[model samples]
Target: MTDNPTTERKGHCLCGAVKITAKQAPSHVGTCHCNMCRRWGSGPFMELDCGTDVAIEGEENVTIYPSSDWAERAFCKICGTHLLYRLKGSGEHMVCAGIFGDIDGLEFTSQVFIDEKPAYYSFAEDTKNMTGAELFAMVQAQQESD
Candidate 1:
């Protein structure tokens, strides 16, 4: 956490119900091409390597909508702040990178579910494309290592 309170990054969902504060900016950011992400974010939702230390308050007011059997989308019930989308059966939370207050130098490096991405919209930005199978395989491998 930053000692100089002024440097702390702060943000909340569209609704003031779900507020977040981070001491430091995110280390990485990228977009997801998975259909669930598209439907949840209206566009490729940005993900951040936030680790677990990120403090999330007012969780009670957040609405968790299970987008699929394997995932859940979280939004603020009062203000409908699209806060987070968590993968099912995992301890990880994919936070929206765009919400990081005044963050800069973010680069999109990979696009998961590229094969399923809509054809009408093309990604002009450079990023490594990964199929759903490829991503799931990697996730499975990580789970096994844990």
Candidate 2:
């Protein structure tokens, strides 16, 4: 926890029905290109690492869905904005980067489930890419060690 003023950021849903405050937001952004993500919004899911230090001003306006066996997703109930993807075990929240408008030095660091990414669309940022199988393997390795 560095004394960076930008670490604490605030954002809201498209219709202003729900507001978000991330107390320790990271500057790195990533994308998930799994099939579920594509079906969720017809494209890759862009996310920011918001961890668990998040505050929801209008919690009643958000709806969460257990998208996978180990992860869940949420969105604004009023405007249908895809809000976040959360990890079940660690309780980590990766919020949608679009909702935060713009941060000063955010970086497109990595792309997961790259093998599932569609051929028609691509990013030219030269990010670190990980295939879906590699992602699961890494998770399994970690879980076994724990």
Candidate 3:
């Protein structure tokens, strides 16, 4: 139930066209409520930050969209399943949370683009919620510090 660096997790696209393996358990699991994410998945996009320790088995079947100046959204080209959201600056990969079947011990820690989250739905878990602007500023500050 902890974020263990040595743990490995495996998953595949809906059509099994692309397989993914992460060398470490995610440090964070988060939900994104931005318009782009909502439109992409018909709801808030839940994801696991797999960092740089992820490997793709069928990269040729993956397509990437430059969703923003700082990030790109990737998906399985064949089945149209969302694959990963990647940071352009750091190359960090946030894989779709549902892709990994029967995973345990992952924690839901935060939500981003909170200002855009629809009022019709809410999560009961108390999580750190960050507005789009706040998230961007925090990311920028982190990059600058790095």
Candidate 3 Cα deviation (angstroms), residue 101: 2.1
What C-alpha lDDT, on a 0 to 100 scale, does residue 126 get in candidate 2? 80
Provide the global lDDT of candidate 3 against the true structure: 0.88
TM-score, structure 3 vs. true: 0.91
lDDT to native, each model: 0.70, 0.88, 0.88
User: What number of backbone clashes does candidate 1 have, counting pairs of residues 3 or more apart or in separate chains?
Assistant: 1
- By TM-score, the better pick of 1 and 2 is 2
Candidate 2 ranges with C-alpha deviation above 4 Å = 1-6
Q: Which pairs in model 2 have colliding backbones?
A: none
lDDT at residue 57 of model 2 (Cα atoms): 87
| Shift in Å, residue 45, candidate 1 | 1.8
* Model 2 weakest 10-residue run by lDDT: 1-10
Instruction: Give candidate 3 misplaced runs (Cα > 4 Å).
Output: 1-6
The true-versus-predicted C-alpha distance at residue 127 of model 3, in Å, is 0.7
The Cα RMSD of model 2 versus the native structure comes to: 2.9
Check candidate 3 and list the clashing pairs. none
